[model samples]
Target: MARIPGRNPWLAWPAGIVCAAVVATLAWLALPMVPVVVAWVGESLRTATSPPVAAPVEPSRAPLLEIAESDDAIDCRRLYPDDLWVELAWRPEALLSQDFSAPSTSVASLTDALAPQVRVTCRWRFDGGGGISSTLARVASDSAAVVEAALQGEGFSCETAGAVLRCRRAQGGAVEEHAVSGDLWLSSVETGRVPEDYGARLAEGLWGAG
Candidate 1:
């Protein structure tokens, strides 16, 4: 094979390929890194020049006057003495009240939901400041059936007249049970000393008051 007059074929071809490869490598390293270098330099300048940031503030909460009571029973401790106390005396002014200034007062409070309704079981002397202990119970309600059953079962002769459960113990004393609504029972239990027909008056106030 004869060579052409001004042509060095192998040298020319290889020189061109080397130049292309070098250009490609430089482009690969420089072009993609340009934006990244510029961003880093700008961020560094901004960080060095910018002011310090302040911390965020938190919101304040409102103050409470009293703690809330649980929804269970009507806790007497949480309530005022008067709120829990209600008239339980018989026709207070009839005979007892006429004789005594304050009368052997009858007051009642309710209990927890487990033992629902009002329960009145005590003989308190209001004048002597010796009243029954606070019993957190529901309001008393008079149900003839409930009253009759409870009294009869306890060996007492009982009858439900109107909204009252009247029970006479074998020995003496009157047990007058009254109610406002539901099955709540407020009983005016007396061993003795308490005059007869007094419970009827005491029970009158409680009956249907709910």
Candidate 2:
């Protein structure tokens, strides 16, 4: 028989297998990379178009006091000269009543009422009579209105210069006063002198009782 060129079958088989394996490996690696590239592009678009988030708001540190309609009255006490203590009761009716006595009369009445039992004496000093009168007038004209408005708006009322009491309605039928002072002008709701908080506490007690 005549000699004839023969095919290199060994070489051809190895080369075909190698090409298929390389293609399969590249596809496995590229499949995961495709989604990652798409996600990066989407995030870049969102960052460019979307608005920034707002900052968080801070809360207030001051205390909150609330009074309800059912509250009716409160009683507050204060220390006086000669180791005496004065107690004053404040009622809504008393505050709003036309028949309630003036500060001078209230002072005398309170002193009389509390004297024997508490063994304490009280005297009213109308030293700055005109000042007191003017202060009372200003307070009377604006006090209730101011208080109501403030309570409605801020849930509490405060008079820094005239009085330091913070007024709020208690859970009961009373209003309350806290941190009271004497330098301010307040009509005596009850007899004797009281600290500013007296009014606030009286309000709270009265409201609680009511």
Q: Rate the local accuracy (lDDT) of all candidates.
A: 0.41, 0.35
Return the lDDT, model 1, position 128. Answer: 31
Global fold similarity of model 2 (TM-score): 0.25
| Residues 106-141, model 1: lDDT tens digits | 321112212443222333454432232212134333
lDDT of candidate 2 over 120-205, digit per residue (tens) = 11223322221111002112222444443444454444444332444443323333332222222233222222344544333233
Could you say which candidate leads in TM-score? Answer: 1
What is the Cα-based lDDT of residue 63 in candidate 1?
17
Please state every model's RMSD to the true fold in angstroms. 19.2, 16.0
| Among all candidates shown, the one with the greatest lDDT | 1
Off by over 4 Å in 2: 1-24, 63-210
